[model samples]
Target chain A: MVGPVFTWIAEHPKVFWTAAQQHLVLSAAALGLALALALPLAVVLLRWRRAAATAIALVNVLRTIPSLALLVVMLPILGTGFQPALVALTLYGLPAILINAYTALSEVDADIVEAATGQGLSRAQIVRRIQVPLALPVIFAGIRTAAVQIVSAATLAAFIGGGGLGELITAGMGTLDIPQLVVGGLAVAALAILTELAFGLAERRLNRTRHA
Target chain B: MNWTLANYDRLFTALAEHVGLVATALAISLAIALPLGVVSARRPWAYAGVMAVTGVLYTIPALALFALLIPFMGLGTAPAVTALVLYSLLILVRNVATGLREIPHEILEAADGMGYGAWRRLVRIELPLALPVIVAGIRITVVTQISVATVAAYISAGGLGDIIFQGITQDFGEKVVAGAVVTAALAVVADESLRVLERRLRAAQSERA
Candidate 1:
């Protein structure tokens, strides 16, 4: 057995760290932009409930486009930089967040709505102050799913000349660098796990504090 | 950007491989997950463990998963299909287990009263009732695999991605568009067809009830 992927690690600590940093940043950007776009879309769709099914179906199909295919599609237009990768990743990241957010808001307790109406709370105020807070947990769960998925998919960015831990994986594939490939794979996997666990803990803490 | 017969054969070949790769992986995932799902349904502890393992596997980047498998399987179809199968497990297993678990308790009690054994009840009653949910999972697995199998080209597994990648390298926008459109179309078709199947299965169960 060959020893020490540690040799590669020890020799290029900065490179490894930088790649990991890039992967996280890419994931965050994709997830944040997805949420920013999706949350409002979700809110607006709540009023226009008649069109929600059609809208969700369209988003779902957009999501079914392969992440790699989407990346290539971007290359011709955005021409192979972080911009294209970000756009593709953000699009790839949208369906889950939007669907969950919409569902969560729609499923808010009718009694709560009735009570708010009884109290003279305006429709906008009730949705903003009451429904939004209650929907947070479900929406956060969607964000958690999108975040973890984006980290893995963001690795495809390197294929199109974007920077990420995928750079390590691609570089390794080019040069037959076994240790490099494994390190990149493990790092990306580890990041996904850590992200999910962190979100899990945060959600629990949020739930506990709110209940208390 | 020209539409030409020169690339039609290549696109069709790629589409065939893409479908085969996706089909093979889904078949294998069903064989593996369906049983595991059944067992897990009976044991909360097992269900949790299955969820954690498959959930983590699903999170691995499709490219990295293929690359990791390539070391042992040495590229081509094996590693690609292996990765896709692993990816399918999270959705399939969870849905199968949930489907089985969510079956009404009264139905189970009735089956028991009629002297049904475990396997008999499962084969006759449980499975039919579970088909709608199970099919929903299959639809997800199929559509996701269609997207995933396109990336299989990077591993030399060969799919519609060939056109997309070739188009990227050769600067043929038409070919790229062709590949992407076909890929998206495959996913949509599979999703809708399976959804129809899901509804039918659900209808039969409702009619029986």
Candidate 2:
């Protein structure tokens, strides 16, 4: 099993490299896009309890939709390709990022906010100097969750021509090609573990800075 | 609408298979996680070790795990269930361990003073107290597995995913909508029902307190 996979890797180094690169780019782009949309929306939602509640409820429903379904459901609407895949993956990532950001901001110690208010910090200044720093750890935790999840879900993008490592896995399955399957599975698994560990270390650092 | 009416039988069969797949995997996961969780809860090193192993298993992508299993397990419900069970362990075990570990020391002391042996105390008191958290974990596991199990259809483990995959390949919008809708509904129903059970258990615990 191992020998065959290694031989395949050696024979088609470019194919393996391109798939790995595509997987990374897809995962990264989705995480980046999710953060961009979710964070600002989370900030806005923080000030509105009713809207936050509704948005979170909607996200909860969205979360129940299977990742594959979410990807393919985009076919009719967005058509197949990297763009649709990115959109679906970003939506997959939204819940954790949005919920965590809103909760982190809202859960900042009320007394501290009061002190900041008394100190005459403007709303924007308080958000920048006080709320954001304190919320960073929790928000980072959410980001870590989103990052790991997005990486995993990005594999499904291959089914729709999103061109990720999933293509290798799917092709392997079609042909019962053990070498392709092993290589693809191992690469995706390695990427996911690496993402988890990287974010975990960053999260710990954030916590330490918060404490210090 | 017309497509769904024409294919209701297919839809129902897929939904049933999806439910069965999730149910069987969850049952096996709970059985394994409960004992492991209880044992690990009492031993910090064991907890860490078990978590480390399960965490890695949980980190692997669903499709990747399924792909890896195909050569060994062969495609079908078995490999799909195996993957689902593995994915669920991290969530269920962590929650179970945490639940058991969170029981107040004073409560355990009182149980001991009442002449309850370790086995009896666990069954009669600690497990009950921990029920809410365990149920909460089960809720998450079910919802997540529903989604994962849908993807299991790619391996020919029959489910609503079969319908969705067919729709994707055929470019049939109605089939995709039907599959997604039913899958989401199953998830929501499972989640809400487990949530109710969790809430009830919490209420009972608080009342006892």
Candidate 3:
């Protein structure tokens, strides 16, 4: 299994690299889009207590649609390739980021917010200087979780011709090439771990900055 | 464009099937994960190794994992159950370990002082205290599995994904939406129920503590 994996990598270096890049692009684009929508929505939802439950419930629901089904469902509307993959991954990523942002902001110590207000900080200043900074760790945690999940989920992109390492796994399955399957599986596992480590380092840096 | 009671019945039936799959997968996961978690937690080296292995498993993409299993399991519920259980081990084991470790040393000492043996302490004391966090871990696993299990449709496992996949095959939007709607609703209900149970357990434990 290991032998074939190395051989495949050596023989098809360009193919592997292209697939890897596509995988990264899909995951990053989806996560980025989700973050762009989720952050503001989280903020707005947090402000309107009445809407918080409904908003959270909606995202929770969105989160539950499996990525495979989501991709297939979106294929009709968005067609195949990256768009459907992006849409599916984006929806899959939203709940964690949205909930994390909402909870982290809401969890900001009320006393501290009150103190900041008492010190004559404007509401915007309080939110910008205090709440966001305070909530940064938890929010980043959400982002980290979403990023890892998206990286893993992006493999399904291949199922709909979105093209990723999943192609390797799918193809390997077709031929009963255990080595190829292992290579694809290990590559995906490696990618997820590497992305997680990168985010973990970033999280540590953010925490250090917060403390400093 | 005709909305009718029949449509509602189909929707309900679809939801029932989806929830059934989710429930079965979660139950299987719990059955496997809980004992392994407990045994591993009692043995430090074993616990470390189990955690590391499962942590690696946790990162595997659901589709790939299911696809990989197809050679041996040959698709459907067996592969789906196997994949879901494997995906669940990391969360379940870690939470069980954390819960066990978080049990106050003083409490353990008190149990020991009360002449409670290891088995008695673990059964009568440790297990109860760990229930809250363990339940939380289960909640996460169940909810995650509920969503991920939808992918099992690709392998002919048959659930709400049947409708979704059928919609994709035939280019019908309503079926796709119907599948998604049911899946989402099942997740919400299951997640909220588990959360409520977790909270109730935690409150009871706190009152006792």
Candidate 4:
């Protein structure tokens, strides 16, 4: 099994490399979009109880929709390929990132926020200087979780022509090519593990800094 | 292109298959995770390793995992169940261990004072107290398994995903919609039902002296 996969890798190094890059790009785009929106939105929304509750409820509903269904749902609206693929993966990632950031920010000590306010910090300053730093560890944990999830979910993008290692797996399945299946599966799984470990380390480092 | 009564049998079969796939995966996962969780609770060192390994496994994408399994497990139920059971271990283990650990020391002391032996205390008091949290974990595992089980259809494991995959391939918008609606409904119903069980456990927990 291992020998065949290795030989396949040796024979088609470029194919594997390109697929890996596409997978990374897809994951990164999804992760980046999710964080860019979820982080600030989490902080802002938490200030309004009704909005936060509504947003979170909607996200929960969205999260339960199977990614395949979601990708197909996107097909009519976005017409497949990169845009729909990114949208689907980003949606897959939102709940973890948004909920985590919101929960972390909500958990920031109220007294600490009050003190920062009394010290003449603006609301934004209190958020920036006080709320955010304290929320980093939790938010980082959420980001890590979201990142790994996005990487995994992005593999489905292959079904939608999203371009990635998923393409390899999808092609393998289409052609009944076992070697392609083995190489593609291993690559994506390795990517997920590496993402988890990398984020896990970052989380530990952030935690140490927070403690120190 | 359109939904018809003719498809009902297929849809129902897919739903049943999906349910069976989830049930099998959760049962297998629970069997391994419960004991492992207890040992980890007793041995703090084991907790980290167990958590890290399961956590990594949990992150593996379902399709990729099916890919990895195909060489050994082959297509259909075997690979699907193995991948899903692996995915479920992390959450279930954490929940059981946390539930066990969070049992207050006072309660255990009281159990001991009542002449409750280790096994008796575990079966009678500790497990009952931990039941709610463990159920909460099971709820998460089930809902996720339901969702993940759809993807297993891609590997010909036979589930709601069969409808989903076929709909997409056939460009049958109605098939896609029907499949998505049922899959979503399954997740929501399973999630809410387990929630009731979870709440009932909580009510029982709170009633305990």
Least accurate 10 contiguous residues by lDDT in model 3 chain B: B1-10
lDDT of 3 by residue, B1-209 (tens): 24323477766766676677767877887787777877887699989899888887887777677766765678678888788788888998888878998888999999999999998898899989999999999888887787677877777777777777777667776677667766766777788899999999999988986
Mind giving the per-residue lDDT tens digits that candidate 4 earns over A75-94? 76687688889988888898
Q: Please list the C-alpha lDDT of all candidates, in the order they appear.
A: 0.86, 0.91, 0.82, 0.87
At residue B99, give the lDDT of candidate 2: 95
Clashes (backbone N, CA, C under 3 Å), per candidate, total 0, 0, 0, 0
Candidate 2 lDDT, A36-146, residue by residue in tens: 999999888877889889998998878777788788876777888999999999999999998899989999999999999999999888888999998998899999999
Sort by DockQ, best first: 2, 4, 1, 3
In order of appearance, the predictions have TM-scores of 0.94, 0.97, 0.84, 0.95
Candidate 2 structure quality by residue, lDDT tens digits, B3-64: 99998999999999999999999999999999999999989999999999999999999999
Pairs clashing in candidate 3? none
After superposing candidate 2, which stretches have Cα over 4 Å from the reference? none
> In terms of lDDT, which candidate is stronger, 1 or 2?
2
**CA shift of A173, model 4, Å:** 2.0
- lDDT by residue for model 3 over A12-36, one digit each (tens)? 8987888888898899899999999
Interface RMSD of each: 1.6, 1.3, 2.5, 1.2
Candidate 1 lDDT, A105-180, residue by residue in tens: 9999999999999999998998899998999899888888888778878888887777899898889888988888
Least lDDT summed over 10 consecutive residues: which range in candidate 2 chain A? A65-74
True contacts kept of 2: 0.65
- Which pairs of residues collide in candidate 1? none
Best by DockQ: 2
